[model samples]
Target: MSLSAASRPELDDTLAIRRRTLTLGLLTLTYFFSYMDRQILAILVELIKADLKLSDTQMGMLGGLAFALFYAILGIPVARLADRANRRNIIAVSLALWSVMTALCGLAQNFVQLLLARIGVGVGEAGSSPPSHSIIADLYPVEKRASAMAIYSLGVVLGGGFGTMIGGWLASQYGWRVAIIAIGVPGILLAVLVRLFVVEPKRGLSDAARVADSSRMPSIWSAFADMWRNAAARHLVLAVTLTSMIGYATSYWGPSYLQRSLGFSVGQVALIVAPIAAIIGTVSGVGGGRVADWAAKRWGIHAQSWMVGLLKCAALPFTILFFTTDVPAVAITAYVFNMLFANSYLGPTFAMLQGLAPLRTRAMWAAITLLVINLVGLGLGPTMIGVLSDALTPLVGKEESLRWALVVAVSATPWAIFHYWRAGVMLKRQQEMAA
Candidate 1:
């Protein structure tokens, strides 16, 4: 029996929902591994440093700038392809590329080789998130988008946690190389699964008829222009970049701080800090998304208000408490809250950007925003602290240099809050224009 056109639309809608769920789930899992590979170095920093006979600056370059530089610079072109081409294929291929590169990191015999391998990993990872964001925007309606994105952002916490726990255990038992290989290999199989199982959904499938238009797709340059015109997008990207500087600085250096100040071994530091930070970060990341949603619904305010306001209020005290406290238990408690608060911005900010970007340009816009965030945040944050640490070493000693560097880094958090607030105001204006 042939179905009527009306019946066909309904059938298509049902199928789209199922496909979207499958696609999002697979993408999120893939992201989890990507994050794990990126962060495993944090847990194994001391071992890698000693084995390679490297300085703090060199380790910072490997973990922070080397990967981030390529990742940031290459993201735009890849995202342009993702915006116009087959995003599912882009993501699958990207997963495979990064996975292989990660495994190659295990084979690196020297600092240069490892650095080059990491650059490869960065190139591959540059392809994952922007396409995933665009695809997810296609799947969910505007109102529910933040919550959906939040769920996906949980990969960050899961990846970091697993990397620390698993990477640490492997390094402790075997070696760092084995840890790298173990984490890298699973992504290959997962990449195959992604290509086989995930189907792309129609762009703007969940939006109102007025907002969905196949012919409205813009060029990559046009997409960037659109983002520039949207004040909310501009402010959101700036705020996210600034806050990310603080967050990256802390996450990258916190392990070393613990090792120096608390005198924890590599294995012990992994056991204590990794699980605690992971649990707190994951819970807060997810909870932040929900809170933003809740706040938006209950008050007639933009979700950015809830996001930015929370950050501003929490930044100063958390910074002061975290750096100044000498007690490990107190420090950990402070660090947990800091991680939670810092990560809270992830879901709301991304959701806002996705909303502002034209449907056809979602991936490109997301990629551009990521480029800025990583270049400024990941690329510079840790390196800045390392520079500060090195410069202050003679005056304050190595340990105190790190401590003072953190204190200086935390100052960026307030700047992030201001941008977020500006984004909130712009969001209101954009909403009115859309209306």
Candidate 2:
């Protein structure tokens, strides 16, 4: 049975670069809204705590386990669907679902109700990234992918910043309820836009001609098996998970830490700290992608891993200093440096993930990677820090307890750096073997 020429992948330059750019912009806006809905809770943490009479541990559960559990679990199936189904539709439905769930969060009268609502948000968001990643891969070639994906990745910064700002301002002005509702409802409109405007691309359209024809989609178990067998993939998964743990913990707690420990009000945290961190995050996220693309051009496939590893290593000292310092200005400056380096990996790391994966299994590989990341990072990061904070409260009091707990989170960066280094080395070897 000879494969037909028509079955072989031909570069479909049918999607113009401008269309690709527009698609990226639209998807990035979708991602931005997705993250904003998810993270708005961070800025509203204190208000929720006060109203619900909740402990930090409980708050942590809402932030991490409650949301991440369903999110991580459902991502596999959703990504599986994305592999075969219409990705744009999956993303549109997901946007609407999460937006509605986010609005419902405002209506919850108790912790359990709120927890369920957050869980709903998680389930909705699970449908977003995998398909989005797959689409981006189809839209751009390997050389230009990191930068394109980096633009999409700005959703993280924009959403986080806007979530904090809008959530905080709404909470301050009307209440947290209003804030949640305000942020959540707009996404439903965006979902409609997605359905109307976004055109789906043919799989493998952007790749070079003569690709192996994978007529059948791989099973989920096979995806897991592939990752387990590949040393570079395994290490990359662990590396991102560790870094995400640190990143999630910091972003989730930073608002409370600043308010309680540094004597900043919610307004101040929203207006000053959030904006500063957002700016740094935006710059680093975009710059990292461009730098990664450049590195790949100059070096090789392994260049991205090295870039991520070096950034992680460089960010460590600043992270520790941010946690240890008492001076407001110095602490904020340190935090700025941490933010700058902390997010730089997202563009390159994801680019590497997309590149390393088998084309047929790309979305599932992303889902599997995210499952580990969210389970360990979002699932445990906040909860662990909150538990640690509660444990140290009697001895050190609230402020110092939170400070040290953050330090504990930051301590994990070194472990993340090690894995990144290993992934880089393995990637180089893997590339060598291919060559």
Candidate 3:
């Protein structure tokens, strides 16, 4: 029997916290494999390019836009499902689907086959983050959410590192095909673990019970309309999309840059670059989350604005240094800092978006934001860089073309900063309304 309204608050709060932690941990592991499967292709790029006789441009397509096109297009619908249905099951099914497709990448005999396989991977991964975000928002109070998300975001760095370290050794020892299989198989097992353990928390369990007085569930269309009505979310989406364009473009091309410019072999670059990038990225992601949490508590809701401001300021010079400096040590150092700053946004921005969205539409709003972010950022970033690199090759040669392309790409940082500042102001208004 349902509890009396007065007694439900304490019961729900206690149960919600427990469920949030369990589910968040499960989702984090899910992300670990999701990212590993996605990034394995980068480590294996040399072998694939050589075998398929594909140009760098084609590799960029396979890695970035081709997969991202499906991922971006499908994310919103799937996210809407998460809002309406059981998110735990959505994650479970998605995990298994992506794992099988990742294994299929091992069997690809040509670029077309690999492209199709990557597209499948994209479709599966698209199902993960939005639902996970919605769950986390319901689990944690606004003050604690950035750190929670920061911890969750660690999966990206760890996954990237492991994918590179393991993918590198496996590719070096057996072949690229075997590397793909090794990374893909583990995720299927994790799917079962998630389905068994994660319990869905009541939506908005951490917030004051006053919010429950409103409709418990809103329609997806109403939720989407609410998100659109918020100027802060709109501006934040714009900023994130622009910054992500720069970030994704650089991430896609950076390994290639090292190989082309520095003459590092696949094994060599993987060993040298992956560890550094992963370690720094993981640390920064967690650290940024903590910092955002602290700032929100001490400085108030404008904490995200401060966090974004610091990242933008830090990123500008380091990005410039990354390309212009000839010293490997200096360049790598710059790159490490660039990644650290670039990734700091993931936890804070996501937490803030959830805070802004009405409880019922949280998942849908997340999906809509991701749809724009992925379509604009993931879909175009690398492909644009690839096209520019190819076009500039005739004029400046491949090495210089890539360098210049990166320089142009890095210029998007300032735009990201402007929109983040606007989001902060909007967040204050939102918090006031909630109060």
Candidate 4:
């Protein structure tokens, strides 16, 4: 840690630890707002649909495709900039842009206006994650990266939790518009805090080996192609893409399913899903990182990859039960188990991606992963469910169609499991060569 921050010779180890904690904490807050801004819409889905007289497909487009297209596509160029520019500035500006756009979402009276606002929010968010990921990697060494990444990822769970819980309560009390505006505006203040407090770290600071970086920046295509050519990275990306497809679909639609099928109000669904899911996701996410780090050291990195694969497979039964069963007790119990295993993949997967990515290409690699996953997962997953629900309406009846569509979404886990296992195999081959 001292070697990485050697430029700041005045700061002792204790101060360094304190600064690192502060940086991670601020980044986590930034991330928390990002998710909160994006996810608050999910809790408002039913209310928005009813007020605007919109269909499920339109709601899906609002929540998923429109936002994801800009978010995923622009991540590359913005991340390329982060690879070279002052990443802290990029993150600060990005947060402010998205926060304003999120506030704009409350003002929209129709589909096009809201869609454009969500797109603006997406454009802003495109700049946040890659830089943030690169920063965390620079601070935390590979051995400690899973836990570090897990800490950062807590933003996702916490933000999602509060976004839904708060959004729902506010929507129920005031209106969806007020809930959205209220949630979105606070991010600007957080952005100010970030720019003032967070000191940008030197890139590649945490790596044990000195990776040679070039003076010239590589094009996004070139960088992404280089990562894809690596077998482990290729498989890992596929696995994550598949898993995200499952995740985004469920998260975007889960509340709707609860409200529509199970006869719960939006407020009730949000209350039930938010706290428990957040708590479970938090514990599992952090624990997964600890377990993966230990597994990598005890056995090998290959063992860590295998662990991700096995856990996804383990979640299959619960995934089925969570979607299929209507009984609240049985269904919620199944959801908890599914979340335990499902959320576990995040830290281990990201840590492995960071380890595999080249120093110069870290931000680009992170962006490309987001691009592929969001394009497929966020862009298509919920949309597919919407389209499928529309198609299945005749067969299952309109209300039950969403539940069935969610069932279909979870079916892709086996395919994701295959890629993770293949990544483990590829890692083992590399380990053998090194030995």
The models' CA-based lDDT, in order, is 0.82, 0.88, 0.83, 0.88
Q: Candidate 3 lDDT, tens digit per residue, 1-435?
A: 466877876776677676777778899989889878877877777688788898878887877898788887788889888987889899999999999999999999988898999999999988998899988888888889999988888887888888888888889899989999999998999999999888777777777752633545666667667877888888778888898788778877777777777666778767888898888988888889999999999877666865776788887898889877767788888888887787788788888888777777788888888888888888888888888888889998977788788888888788889889888887787778878
lDDT of 2: 0.88
Which stretches of candidate 1 lie above 4 Å from their native place?
A: 1-13, 433-435
* Candidate 4 pairs with clashing backbones: none
At residue 391, give the lDDT of candidate 4: 87
lDDT of 4 by residue, 1-435 (tens): 666677454353334345788988999899999988987888888899989988889988888899999999999999999999989899999999999999999999999999999999999999999999988898888889988888888887888888999999999999999999999999999999999888777677778586638677777789978998889989999999999998889988888988888778877877887888889989988898899999999988888789988988888999899888879888889989988987888778878888888888888899999999999989999888888888899998988999999998998999999999999999889889989
lDDT accuracy of residue 377 in candidate 2: 96
lDDT of 1: 0.82
Give each prediction's root-mean-square deviation over alpha carbons.
2.3, 2.9, 2.6, 2.7
Instruction: Write one digit per residue (lDDT tens) for candidate 1, span 23-72.
Output: 77898898899889887788777788889898878778887899899998
| Two-way TM-score contest, 2 vs 3, winner | 2
Q: Name the lDDT value of residue 102 in candidate 4.
A: 99
Q: Which stretches of candidate 2 lie over 4 Å from their true place?
A: 1-13, 16-18, 209-212
